[model samples]
Target: MQVNTSNDVKIYNLSAGRSQPAWISERKRRQMERADVNLRRRIQLIQDFEMPEVSQGIKVSPDGQYVMASGAYKPRMRCYDTAEMSMKFERCTDSEIVRFLILSEDYSKMICLQNDRYVEFHAQYGKYYRIRIPRFGRDMVYQPELCHLNLVGASNEVYRLNLEEGKFMESLQSSFATEINSCDINPLHQLLMTGSSNGYVEAWDPRSGKSEGVISCDIPDLISNGSGLSVTKLKFRDALNLAVGTSTGHILLYDIRSPKPYYIKDHNYSLPIKAIEFILEGDLIASMDSKILKLWERETGKPVTSIEPGTDLNDLCIVPDSGLIFMANEAPKILSYFVPSLGPAPKWCAFLDSLTEELEETAESAIYDDYKFLTADELDKLGLSDLIGTNLLRAYMHGFFVDARLYKKAKSIVEPFNYEDYRSHKIKEKLQAEQSESRVKVDKLPKVNTALAKKFLEASTNMDGKAKKKARMVDGNPLEDARFGDLFKNPAFEIDPTTEEYRLINPLVSKIEKRRKAKESHAEEEDVEKGEKEEPTELPDLEENGRRGEQEGSSDSSDDDREWVAERRKVHRTIRDEEYMERQTRRARKLLMVDPNRRGKVTEVETGTVPLISGRGVNKANVKPLGARLDEEEKQRGGAEEVQLAGGNRQMTFSLQSKGYERGREASAKHAMERKSVHRSSRGIGTKIKKPWKGKK
Candidate 1:
């Protein structure tokens, strides 16, 4: 998904085992003479095969018998037989090829991805079939056990298709935040690993179709510095180790056992890495633009060497058995490099000492700069007799050694020291430190006692002897005066006449005021003697009142009437009678349970009077019954003894209709009101005439 913006990316058609040109051969020969002897002896320019079309991918068959090459601008996938080192057959596709792979255990057929949308399987006999995908696929991997080719699309969606049937079976949603750029399958672990353009590498379980782990490849500094790196290529060394190439030309090798990458290699050109692979167990090889190839040792993560193969390349592949590196480039040719078999040499070395020596002969000449024989007497004089045959002396002389054991003796300022010496040294250091501190000058400021400070400064000044003598002369004066003798006679202060203390009072009244008071008192007595007329009071039932008056003997005197007026006023100022009526009704309703025949006959008194005790005056005879028909009561009882209801003290209200049965009666009435139309026969035979009514005169 990452475009090569630094330079135009061109593909080439590649062929292997082809002879190189004369100029190329001469160049290789000249370089060999200058190369180190070990490299010169083992490395050789094997062959180069040139074609017309640009190659997009180059891969060796699983059996290693054929080398297949496909081009981005060409329709044919060419295969070269390793035995003959010549083109065997060409399977042509409808679209230009982008990548090609040989299906495992099916060498007779090969799969080609063209234009990122068409996937074609080409047979050896030149017949092929292709499945057109909906979107552009960035990378793909074949799962042998599942018989599905997992393709990663530009939108980060992964599609799994049955390779034989070429039908989409399932799609695993993207596990990354960006488009997938590269993908690989770990056959041993059965895990699918995908790399994205945003530097995320995620591992997925194909069987469960779930993401297992994820790793971000972008280094913090690179992204922070605005040089975000994208994953350009991914190669799995095995089930446990993975090699990743980034757009920033960084090679990262990750081990499944750890969260971080185990090895990393950075490049100077900052070109996108085209391919990455584990060539020989521990050595890694990576390729970039301008045919730049680099080799690194896995143990040290150090580059062994780098070379430019005289042209820009598209991709790289390695033949494991032959130790040959094949590169597809823009020159319409595949370049091959035969790696030297020599062990790595020191990077800075010539042919003379390119390889390190196995062992060294340790003798007097090799140990010391100059050799000399020392006598036992001379050794004793120099204090060297004790170390004459020991390795300590030998190591001190030799600048370099292969089989010498070296150690450093503990260093000390004093040859030997005891506890007393240590204590004395410490005391000396402390005294020195104290003396140094004492020599330092510190500024001091004057101090004042704030607590004793006076709240106010006195204005007094010291008096001279002359001022003190003058102060004694003005002591006592004014012995007496005429006004001072008369001060008591004239009242010390005159009281204001408006004050109550100076006011005069008299109780006598004049004749006019006394006459006015007598007339007013006389008028008040006359008004009391002539009182206003009173209104007459009438009872609700005059006949009943008359009968009660006869039985109770008209006991309504002025005192009793006044008492009733006061009691009525007191009752009006208190809580209303309605407050206790409901409670009293509930209590009296309980009395109705004692007489079953008293149900529905309860009535309330108008005056809210209830007789607490039988025959008491509290049961006033003037009270009127509420909510009961007097005529109906008269008919029921035949004017006999008044059968008062058991719960008759409660106030009542009346309505014409029954409340609890209204809904049922209305529903029944609605049903009875329903009528159906009946058609009468048009013939007169079905009609009957009505007869006239006879007068009852």
Candidate 2:
């Protein structure tokens, strides 16, 4: 019964007349303009149709091309075209169509229950059949996939009627003891859900004739008369969500996987819901007693809007593809409204229109607070903290900060502060600080020039006086000095491919070869000395050999003494025998072994005699070998070849036939390919002329 009052209130009071102030008139003009802007964007009445009779049910076709309605009192039905807005067909029968009409997918045929006793079917053009039923059907649903019409009877029984055969197949007994009031089928999942009068809802698998699950509505709040509330309507919003409407005006939504409903809502009018449906976008629409239609956003459980058409609505239908709502009532007029799909508006043009009153209230509050400043916390609560300094002032001056100037200013302030770069820089600084703290610093020492020290060491180490004098005489020769100086000046710097390779004089080569020979001679002499040191000695030392022999004799005597003592113990220990000792350990309880022939046997009365035996047996001489006995038993049991022959023969025959078939197919394929190749060769130029030379001649 709750309705949106947006249409009842006015923004400005223009009725203050011509004597009102200028500001009042201006305000009234603005309000009128705003109202004019919003009227075209919202839900609005498009057209209405006058029913020829009292309509009991209204439904739109799946393709949204036709609207069908069945009359309440008379057995009459009519179909209308949605695009053309004209009646396509109409028919009247001997029995009333009742409150339900099911149409085939192609709309070529229709079926309806008549007086809970018979079902009337109508085909294209004009063909009809009335079939009798054993039980009174309270509710019926048609499953297109199975091509069957499922009926729930007053006796809590479910029956399937084949549409093509036009006969009742059989009945499935429900577990519920009370009568079922409503039933629906989920075409996608092929499931049947039935609701009983005692608020028990059970999902049935028609194929198995067994209940899939049962939903208990026995909660204390939803129960009445020491039982559960009556289920007036049961509908599936989708394959997974079920919407159950009760006579108490409570709509409970349950997920098929759980026992409890995830959402519950009350209409508050306490009237039986006539029809419940979910639109293509998942919003719920419910109409009760034809007085009001409620639209709810399924996720929020909040009413989007409520429309009162001033008539008792009996049924509702929505054309999902066209976004149009159709409602039928007791009144002759059938109302239709066109509403756009619900979502965020592409352009919210009515922003100022919605905020005029809110702005006025805030202005009044501001005057009382004397324009006090808002703290940082308060600004954050208002979600304006990002607009800290100049940006906040700009928003106040411009009424709202949507201008390009404000956007650029804010972007300039935020563009330089990238979170990743700041974090990386802080990490680098932390690592450097930690490394500095872990290591100790000391003053650096100056380097010493080693060129003079190197020359002094060389002069002192190579003090061959006679060799130096001869080298000085050789250096006196201009040719020799020039050659020797070039080689010795920088023997390491031999060649630079870019510059040294193009030199005019090559004195460094000969001097370098002489120095190389001298180095080789020195290396050869050092190797000879190492070989002599590595050679083994040819003679042994007498004193060392004498000491080694004395040590070996002393060790051998100690080993001999220990061996004698061990031998003596082995010889004497046999005379001292000791009893074997057993250690006890904890284990599970067990009984000790008992002798089988502990009591003496009686020999007075010869009941049995043994021929010759060393064991306990009455007829020991006649005992047979185990192997011979097992061989005799095997002869009686026989082989398993007979049991396995049937299966093995069939398998071998199948494999042989399959192999032969494959070989035949391959042979045929080879013959076909050979014929094709011969045909192509005969058509070629080489084969076209039987004798090329003869044809030319």
Candidate 3:
């Protein structure tokens, strides 16, 4: 014998009625007030009533006074008053409630079809009567006018039980070989509608026990896999409209007169649909799979709304004429959802409408709720380090929050490498490199002297015979052409005396000398402007005869004067020759330096060995000096003669000596003599001479 145990049963009272006792504690009162406020919110989960085990089914009575739910562990049904929203009573049964129906508004009479193929009837007090059926019942429906209970299960026939007679009655038999999964009765015509495992929905008349019509549902076309077309639920809005839920997560509505479905809705998850019902006076149809709850328009086949519960959903029932829906799931608690747009809250929770209004006015949703925040390191790992400072990532306190879609896209892009793309990119780079190398490139021209080129062009175009003759006459040279005359004649082509180029070439003329010359010129101009005049002094004159006699008497003094004049002439000549030689040497050095092959190969030649004539044979005023002869010789030799150094590849020159050349030559000669002496000593030390026979000597 099995002992009845109620130890595991639990009851929770979640009501927040306005009528509270004065003796209630402050905390309890505050809690009730908070619950009342939450219930007023538009669309929210208002209640979570726990059960002993997973709830099988839940429903609100026709009068909307109480909600009844059946569960396992104790195989009991609990009824919660709608006004108080608390468990009013619990009824324990021998078998678990598989499917249940409330017969009256008071919920005093209920018919529970158990999983053990038992049909149980209970009154307000307890289980009144129980009977066994041939097959396990999957679903059941009741007809009050006939006092009959119709059930369908694994068998091809639906079992009927007469409640008033309290005995078994004739079963409704279907001609199809498929087992019936669910059954419902049409209210207007009182015709029985049954959905079968073979995707057939058939309507039958109870009086005649004959088939009225049949719908194939074409389950293979509705699902991609083309399997599991067994209808799991059937709900009727009236005599003509019927809703069917299939095992393939499809909800099909049909008109009993037509075989094809009116509108078919997909739950998308493809889980077997658990329950379906028409709510709000048949304006909307509610369907549930194991994953979500969906409500859709009756006329338009568009989805009205949907809810994804935290747990797997087993059954759903919408409160009569209200948006509030109670859901039984694979958890100990029954979840309730409210949709304000579908309908208002029930009268018991009338404050929900006002609370939703207040919430809409004040509630603020967080902007980052849809974003995922990551730090710098995490971003680097995702190859999104470049987005650190970009607008795609919004900066929070320590990291950034990027849009979820963007993050997903970035992760996908950075995760894998395509070898084809890499190969193509490398090939493109190689082609570009080859093209760059093979393509001919031209050097950019240096900036042009526009004025000079233009003048040359103009002169060449307009040259006349007279201009050519005049240019030739100026120098009597072939290079003195009229087209090239401007190059020599134009002051713009000449180097300015005050410029750095002129100063570098003429190192003898110091800046102080230039300044002194400028001052002298300025003073002379001032004198000329002032019209200054100066008095001239008259020179004393001596007779020719008297000067001759004086010279004869003072011969020594005359000789001294002649010697002084000769010395002055010699010194002046030396200075002029040195300057000319220096200029020639510089020109030669520059020429040798420009030739790459003869660079650093030069020798200095002293041209000062020629004796000076003391103004004896040559006319002092008319004859050109030796310096002029040297200048012409240098020009004829093309600046200087090439001379190789004594050592291999050494730089030497045969150009004329410059200033400080004598000191450099003396130092080099001294170094050479010392080196020669050192070499002789080293040779002497390394060798030995032997004397014959006279060792002592």
Candidate 4:
């Protein structure tokens, strides 16, 4: 194995000895500053708790004092106290809880709908009672004033359970064609509403069990050319306002008095919405699907923000009037998200604000978090080779690190110019300019300039005389007005050079006078120099002879001949002797005539030619000609040639009338006719008899 001698690991000094480079410290400082700013601008996860199993449902209690969730693995329910931030109690049920509700604000009583068509009730300590319904329950809501518990499930009916009587009451039959999916009760008016799988929300009077009105939740634009949509969730902010979530990831807010929706919001995931709630006093609406959670404006339907938890979301509950939201998902832990802009943190977690503020003031991200460190060679691949020595690259150990934004900017700068984009941009600008220029503009004179306007009108009406011309001149030139006559008069004050103030101001006047005199003297000297002539210098005799020789050499030559000689001299000066000779040889070979049909065949005229200067020291006479060598090789091979037949058979044929041809043919015939005799050895094994040698001996 080969060992690496180069030190690839960097050692940083821990003590304050100034061992690190200045840029490293500077980069660290800048990263710390950036992280501090980002902390204050984004949402943060403050705390979390692990559950025994995957949480199926989660919700904050009505009094905002505790969080309750139900999960599997013996099918238990766990409640966490928000103030203490710990589990208050856990109770195991006979089956898994599909949905649950906290009936009392003091966390004394709770109701859970199990998957086995059973309704389980619990007090502050443990399980109190259980009741099995007719069908599997999907959702439930409790009305405090009527003391009635309403549950909707897989059937087209709403089952009512009176908590005061502790028994099942008369069930309300929904007139929907499909199964009921969700239901809600209006807080102010106590009106019952049930959402069906057929995309209809039916509001009923609970006292009479009669349908009051039906609202169609299907959006034609969303459901066009698609299957029918189902209502997954329904929330009522007050007596009149209602929010409906559909299977196609749409949230429709409506005023119950009108048939149309007030505004429509889409989750954009195309998944069934699991939960919808009105937070921040009904100003913002939060909707969730299995994929994403979104908070958007209720009045305008503009999206506020969204978060993807990278897991399947089961349910989410917002703390009463606050921004804190607790989510139950497929994971074993519940997640909480805080949106500071929506509302303040709950009083139980008020310390979170101070903790985040401290982090914003002191915490820092990693030094190379958002920067890409690259060497000079790596930068060349990105076309940033020209920026190696520039300040845009921060110098690190043996390379440089640039901000992500700066890297993108530099890469774009070095990119080739896009001529098509430039041309199109210019064309668009030209069109806009042409449209602007063709548009007519109306300019109105100020009402305060009535006198000037009157003069202008009079000048236009009387344009046939000198009086009119005078008026026109007065109207065109504002300075010709009588009120501006004093403005053009000369000032009364004049500078007196004999005074002390003038002397002080003009202190540099003597220097200016000296410069003028020197300039005049310099001009006179230049004129004197122009009038004189200098004597010529004599050339050396050798240089004169060389010049005369060049003149005589070109005197007898024509222009073309002279140009050819000069070009040849330039060529000789540029190339070595060997290269020049090779080029001349190539040119001479090209000039020779040859037949294309004779390709790969040697001709008599092209045989036995020796180069004048072969690098090897072999004598030219010792090198045999090509034809002579071929004849000698044929004699050594017994003048016989093998010809391949079409079916891969080989046939040997003798050459005609060649020296040693008869002897080679006889030897080949003898070898083909000779046969070895098979004999039995002493051990009774068969063996081949050895043939006698056919050599001279």
Candidate 5:
């Protein structure tokens, strides 16, 4: 009888109830100093329109309090506030939504697309501004100072409208030859960058109405090497260098001065990549496909971090002020930032950021190598995984994912499960999915089309960039992107005005953890729990094969000839000696494929077909052919289509066959094992020998 025993004696807390690190980047001193920093922000489940399908359009008020949500089947634009689930106005008299819903700089007016491509900029207070532009509406954008709504589409043109007269002021021409996909006006400069279906990225000074430069596909000109890749999005890293995303899931970094782009990033394996955002000052770029949000070092072209932002990410945008980010998904769940007190923000984050310029600059010069993340073993010992989900081990494999924004988001997402004793087995499916370590690395991936990138970025957040008059407003423009002041004072969530209950609270899934008082009580409870006997359900032991599959007594004879025992021993010895004498051309047998001439299948061969073989074995396999077909013996067969040869006697015993001794001896021994049999006597023992199947003639 065998005894079942296990030496396993370790405990792990893979639950949300477990304690997180005090702060990811050593915030002990800072937190201690600012006790009031503990307040967390969350969504309040604002107005949810019955638009169960999808929202094709969205326009938020300048204050971010009122929103206009529309879709293909949706009736008009449903307007409401984030502080309540109640909605008021439905601008029902409208058309299909192809372009975005543009709210005026003051949030008092909105412009929308009609079925026939006519636009109506309706004022929230009184009047409506209408315009008839000749083009398919691809995108609609606006500027405050110009008081003009730029409509981009089949034809590239900017229609200037006078607010007071409600009439066209001037018509400006654009340089695109083909249909324009999308366009954006720079907040700092009047320069506009647009993409087209012909793989062309054209930039223009919208004020001067001239082209800055254009990037054309050089490959499409060649007949044989033509690639049908088209430009998807284009954005400016600066005035000279623009980032372009192509349909091939590649990012081309182009400088207007050079004819060719400097580099291309094809990292997502052509998975229809979604978006890329420079964070922590542009040092890091966050790009997302359907499943993961990957962080890449913009300069080094290496993946720095990643996260599973809960759903299919439709958009990604960074809030440099609070380090908060909004990952717009199909469901539109907002994401928050949780910066480590010590880690650096992205490279571009420094140059492009409004706050933490000092830290961003220092972070640039500082070296970031020696730091290490906590391993699964240590996390288990510290009892942290249980609270965060054992999936954390898998989630964190791409290095620590928290990019300053992660903390705030994670704090909200993880808080509901706090103090709960959840089993790691329950969320296993989700972990295996979103948090698996088998994630392929993206050295450098192309950017998404800037138009799509901007749409997503804008849709994800309420960051409205309107250059207003400098006055008492904080940061000069109160509603634009936040400055350093907001990070310390403003939290993300606004308490719902209606219920006043915690709408952000997640539904409870697991049981609460038991509180312990003394060590004695814990031991007694463990003993009591152990005493409650129950048979564990049967499960297949998959790991058993690794230890037990090896057979101990199997004979090592040739697979075809088990009966010829004597010949097997002699051949094994000869082959072993011959292998050492043979000189190999290269080391390691070239992994799974090998050829003496060092070539792999240049031409594909059909599977399951019987290949023609000669006495030389495979054409490439036979490194040293055994030489010479017996033409004399073949002629003796009377030139038949096929000849049969018998090998019963190699020698009728005559000398002088010049080194034929070995073959003769082998032939003799082969005949002996063919008919060996055994029978048992009175003592009762039985033995029998099997023969190698009749040898080839």
Candidate 6:
């Protein structure tokens, strides 16, 4: 039985009315408010979504991962993945139709039987285990009282199946001469009951496969009514009443301990009753026709409830404790009677009322506490007493009001306030963002040179015609032999160059230069404003030296402190030459082209692609000394400048910007790899049984 304990409501039960708190001081009011706030924060606990199938012959997996339903045209059992929004794993039977489903006691095996009297077994995890139907078979049950797994097959001949071996323990003849139509195992009595097509019932010994009691289900009064004698469905309830629905229309309640019927009721419908069900833990029997399902008491055989089965519905199941009856039909109708007082209260109803009460209180206080407006009749029409809460406000906004002006005015008054509050929040956010941008700008302020303008002017003039001519060498192209041909030039030739041409990195050099100039110009303006006199002793910032000394010297060293500056220059040159020599050797080895090849020698190499001098991978200045210099190579060795990697595949090429690129001959290779698993056969994953991590089997 599915008892829903979580939904038992805690209201006053209509016997007790709300009373005032013992003390109504302002302090007590604060405490109540805190408690109410806490209550609202907790997620409400309730039995939520009902299972989709009001499943008959429901077999839930012992591992609790699946639920199999047996009913409908061809019995269909759906397996499910038991996680949130659990999904169907697979259907049990391949037939696309099933009459009934019986789970073997082991649960590891499931039996799907069509009405032809043959049963098929699908092992829980293995498909190897299956059972063959015995001849002259009736009905079979795997478990009784819906309890443990025990196999029993009975007919004119009865047999107890030994499930472990897919065979029967023994076979025997029953006292009845008819094939069995249905069977029920009474857990309370520990006896297997069999009902035959010829209106006979018998109890069989489970172990020996012998008929223990011989009984007949015929009624003299029903015979007088001239209905054909056939038992439709039978169920043993509580070791007492045997509820049987017949093929005609009569339902008989028989006391299994006696031969006489305890009660009998004939259904009004001429059509045969299809199935019978007993609401577990409740003294009720339900019978269904094609159009309706009827419930009656087992002992009195009097009607308890009736519902239209929506047309075409022929079967149903009463939920364990929910009292909800799910009928199977075109759309699978699930219904619960609206009698809240009968059992667990509807969970949603309580929360709805509580929330609505709070909203109405707020709406009501907004009036009398300020200016009253709502009429009593209008308030009622608005479902203020209905406790609709914010839903009512939502519905009001959704209503089809025809007057455009009225809607516009209402929106202007109400929605605009909410929108304005939101926008003000956004404005504050924008101001915060601007403040962050200003802080970053301030931190990036460059150190200023006091005499930057004078230094710049002097430097510009020093570049006279000769200097200009040298600089002009780079005028048309800063990158001629440099390969770039000229970088950082104005891109007025292209629109949306960023989108069209690929850029590897941001133009940091240009940005840095711009920052330097801006700082210098600003410093000059600051000095002019302060009226500072230019001192003659203000020396030039060693502009003539370029950054050569700056690059090599200790940044803090004064010229006077560098007593061996001349020696250091020689030291730097020697280090550079040593690095150059090492780089050359390494390149020759990597290229595997130590001897001249058809590709030509290093000396004849074009300037655009200077073969890299390897060894220590340093710049041209460092590697020049490592290889034969231009001066020593004219005649003795016959200059060879071209250098390539060992494989002779990689060609060393560089741009003026020193951008390196890896080139490939083709996008598709000459040979493609076959689609085979990457793992070696020894990956060591298997299905071997082992001791579990937590000491679990």
Q: In each prediction, how many residue pairs overlap at the backbone (N, C-alpha, C within less than 3 A)?
A: 6, 2, 8, 0, 38, 30
Per-residue alpha-carbon lDDT of candidate 1 for residues 1-697, written as tens digits (9 for 90 to 100): 0011112221111122212223234766566446634323331222234455577778877777777887644466777776655677666667777666788533587777777498877776765677777778767788888788987757676788886675787677765646887889988978888888888888888888888888988787544348577887888877788888888767787897677887777776678788776766445554454458776677786666565655677878777544455788776656654343422221211221221122111211212122233445544544455675664343222221112222111112222455787999999999997575444222221123111111101100122346545644222111122332333224434334443223221111223345556776888787876565444575478888889987674454444456556655554444345447868999888855553223244443353333334455653422434223344444554423333445754334222334557888988777766642344566876456666789997
Residue runs of model 1 more than 4 Å from their true location after superposition: 1-48, 104-107, 164-166, 224-227, 281-291, 342-697
Candidate 1: pairs in clash: 11-54, 11-55, 12-54, 12-55, 13-54, 13-55
1-697: candidate 5 lDDT, tens digit per residue: 0011112211110110111233344474345335532111111224344233334445445554555565434435566654454576666545665554545543466777766777766677533755677766766566666665666677656555555556665555655446666566666666777777667777766566667777684344322335565555556565566666666666666776786877666555564455655564546666666666666666666755555634454545443433434454454223323333214333323321323222111111111122235555544444455645433333444333223333345455555565443556557766786443334223221132323234323332332234222333334222234442343234433233233132112111111111222444778788998889675688767678544544322332233234344444655665566566553523344422542122221111122334445664455433332222223323433322332235532212111233377788888887766645343355533335555798789
Residue 666 miss distance in model 4 (angstroms): 99
- Residue 576, model 3, lDDT: 75
Ranking by TM-score: 3, 4, 1, 2, 5, 6
Task: Tally clashing residue pairs in candidate 1.
Answer: 6
Candidate 3: tens digits of C-alpha lDDT, residues 1-697: 0011122311111121123323346786577667765324323223335466688789888888888898866788888886776688887788788899999877888888899999887888887878889998888999888898888999899888887887778877888737998888888879988889988888888887788888887656776885657788888887678888888888888887888887888888878888887775548787888888777778886666677655788888878777667788776667665566667778988876655434432222223333677888889888888877777777765788787788878777876676887899999999998676444332321123334444434443344558757655443232335765555566566545554445344433343455556776898798897787555476546587689878885895566557556655665666677779999999987875663323233534333434545666864422545566556545654556556667665434455454487889999999999998877345765457765686675
Instruction: In angstroms, give how far residue 203 of model 4 lies from its true place.
Output: 1.0
* lDDT-superior candidate, 2 or 3: 3
TM-scores of the candidates are 0.42, 0.42, 0.46, 0.46, 0.39, 0.38
lDDT winner between candidates 1 and 2: 2
Compose the digit string of candidate 6's lDDT tens values, residues 439-518.
Answer: 42223222332233233334444344576577654342222224321222233422232431222122333444565677
Candidate 2's C-alpha runs over 4 A off are: 1-48, 223-228, 282-290, 341-697
Model 3 regions lying over 4 Å from their true place: 1-48, 280-282, 358-697
Over the stretch 1-697, how does candidate 2's per-residue lDDT look in tens digits? 0112333422221011111112225666466446653322222112224454466677866655667877744557777765655677777767766555647654577777776588777777764777777777767888877788887767778778887676677777777647887889886788899888777899988788788899976567864445457787888877898888887777888998999998887887777666788765656555454467777767778776666656677778766544445677774446554333332211211232333233221101111111224445544444556666553333332243333444444445655576887899999999997676443322221122233223323333343557557656443222224543443345453444334232222234434455566776888899998887866577778899999999997886677557556655653453232211111211111112332122221111112333444566555424655455435434543431112234332211011133577899999999999998877443467665676355554
